[model samples]
Target: MTSGSGVWITLEGGDGSGKTTQSDLLADWLTEAGRTVVRTREPGGSEVGQLIRDIVLHHRGDIAPRAEALLYAADRAHHVATVVRPALARGEVVLQDRYLDSSVAYQGAGRVLDGDEIRNLSLWAAEGALPDLTVLLDLDPESARVRLDAADKPFDRLEAEKTEFHARVRDSYLALAEAEPERFLVLDASASPEAIAAQIRDRVATLVG
Candidate 1:
C-alpha cells in the first residue's frame, strides 16, 4: 500500500523441508542488516486465520478437497488483511513461511483439483497480492518423509497421505518456479541447516540490492 516501500518474501517447501527454521534465520539476518522485518506463517497469522488453521490442520474427520481449499483461502485472506498488508504498508519486510503456493501445490496438484481453479482461487483470496520473491526449498520426497518422521509428532491427515501425493506437490512447486523465474528462487533444501541459511542470505543480498 505504501508505494514500493516494503517487500513480501514467502518461503515454500514440503513438510520437513526446514521452511520454519530457514524463515527465522532469514528474518534474523534481515533484522541484523537493519531492515524492518515481520515474521509470520500461513493458516494462522491472524486470530481468524488461526481459527481456520486449526480446522484445516487438525480436524480429525475427512474434509472434502474443495472444502479444505476454501478454508485455506479464507485463512490467507484474513492473514493478508490483518498481518501481511499492514506490515508492508509500514515499510517492513514480510517474511512469510508459506502463502498461496501451498494451496496450488497441496490442493491443486496433490488433491487433483485443476491448477487453473486453484490459481483463480488464489487471486480471489489474495486480492491480486503476491510475494515479491518466493523461495522454494527443494527436497526429495523420501528425504522429506524421513525428516518428518524424525520430528516425532503425530502426522496430520494431510501429512499422513501417500507419498505419491507429496510427490505431486513437489512437482507443482517446481512448475511454479519455472513459470515465474523472476519471482522465485529454488534452493536445495537437502543440505545442512547452516548451509541453507547461507544460501538464503546470498539471495536476499542480490534481490534486495
Candidate 2:
C-alpha cells in the first residue's frame, strides 16, 4: 500500500546515458526499503502519450522544432494528469525515467529554442509539479554514442541528431543542475550500476529522513 504523500523523482540524461538502468535500480532499492514505488517514463506513460511518442520518435517526416516541443509538452501534460499526479496523491514514490528536463534539454538546447519560451511552456504544462529531486546521469557524448550503437533498436529522431546537438543537451542539463543545486543530483554515468544506485539510495534516504 502507498501513502498519500509521495515523493517525485526524475532521471535524466542523453541517449545511451543509462538512465533506464539507473532508474530501475533506484526503484528496486526503494521497494526493498518497504516503500511503494511507481517507475514510469515520459512520452509513453499514458495512452495518449504513447501515441504521441510514436509520432515524435518514429515518424520519418520532418517536424519543426517548436512543433516537436509542443508534442512533448502535450504528452507531459497527459502523463502528469493521468499518471504522475494520481500516484503522488496516493503517496507512492514516483521514479520517472525522464520529465520536463528532457524537454528543456532536447528541445530548448538541442533545437536552439528560446530558453525563456521553453521555460514558460514547461511551467504551464507541469503546473508547478516539479520533481522533488532530479538525477542527472552525466556521460561523455562519444561514449554515449557507442552505447547507443549497441542498443537493440535503431536511433530515433532525437537520438539520430548529430553529436553536436547531444553536446548542447548535456551542457544544458549540467547548467540546469547548477541552477538548482538543491533539487539536482549529478551522477557519473561511467560508474557501475550498483555504484550509481548506491548514490541514489543515499540521496533518497537523506530526503526521506
Candidate 3:
C-alpha cells in the first residue's frame, strides 16, 4: 500500500491448509476485477530463492537452526527487493504464499528460538517492509496431515516435522494474528474452499480500492 496503488497480501497457515487453492481463487477474482496480480511464494519466489529453498527444504542433512533462519532471511531480502517492491511500485496486487510469519512460526517457535529474534531478522532482511494484509488460514496439525497425506507428495523439511512441532507453529501463528488483528484476517481453514475464498475476497476488497 505504501509503494503505489499496489496492495501486498500474504497468506499464512500450516502446510496443506488450502493456501494455494485460496490464492488461485483470489488471484482469479482480482484478475476479473482488472487488477494485475503477482502470485509468488517465499523460499522459491525468485531464482536465488529457489536454490536456497532446495537446500532448506530438500537437502539431506541437518542445518543448524540459526543457519536455516539466516537462509530464509536471505531469501526474503532478495525477494522483497527484486520481486515485491518493484511490483508494488508498478501498482500490481502482490499475492504471496508466505512471508516473515512463516519464519517466526517455523524457525522461531518450532525451532525453539526467540520469536522476536526471528521476526527482527526477517524485518531487517526485508528492510522493514511488511505486507499490507496477511490472511491466516488456521487448521489443526492432524487435519493438515490428513490433507497432506491425501496429496501424496513428498514432505518438505518442515512438513516432515512431527505433529507437536506443527502444533507449536500453529500456536505461533495464532499469537501473531492476535497481536496484530488489524493486519491479519484469521479464518477457519476447515471451511469449504468457496467459503474461505469468499471471506478472503471480502477482506481484500477493502485493500484493493
lDDT to native, each model: 0.89, 0.88, 0.96
Poorest 10 consecutive residues by lDDT, candidate 3: 1-10
**Tens digits of per-residue lDDT for model 1, 53-168:** 88988999989999999998888878888898888888889999889998999999999999889888987987989888899999988999999999999997778989999999
- Per-residue alpha-carbon lDDT of candidate 3 for residues 1-209, written as tens digits (9 for 90 to 100): 36488999999999999999999999999999999999999999999999999999999999999999999999999999999999999999999999999999999999999999999999999999999999999999999999999999899899999999999999999999999999999999999999999999999999896
List the candidate numbers ranked by TM-score, top first.
Answer: 3, 1, 2
**Across residues 57-127, which tens digit of lDDT does each residue of candidate 2 receive?**
99999999999999989988889988999998887888898888888899999999976688779779878
Best by TM-score: 3
Which 10-residue span in candidate 1 carries the lowest summed lDDT? 1-10
Off by over 4 Å in 3: none
Give the lowest summed-lDDT range of ten residues in model 2.
1-10
Query: Considering only N, C-alpha and C atoms within 3 Å, which residue pairs clash in candidate 1?
Result: none
Regarding TM-score, does 1 or 3 come out ahead? 3
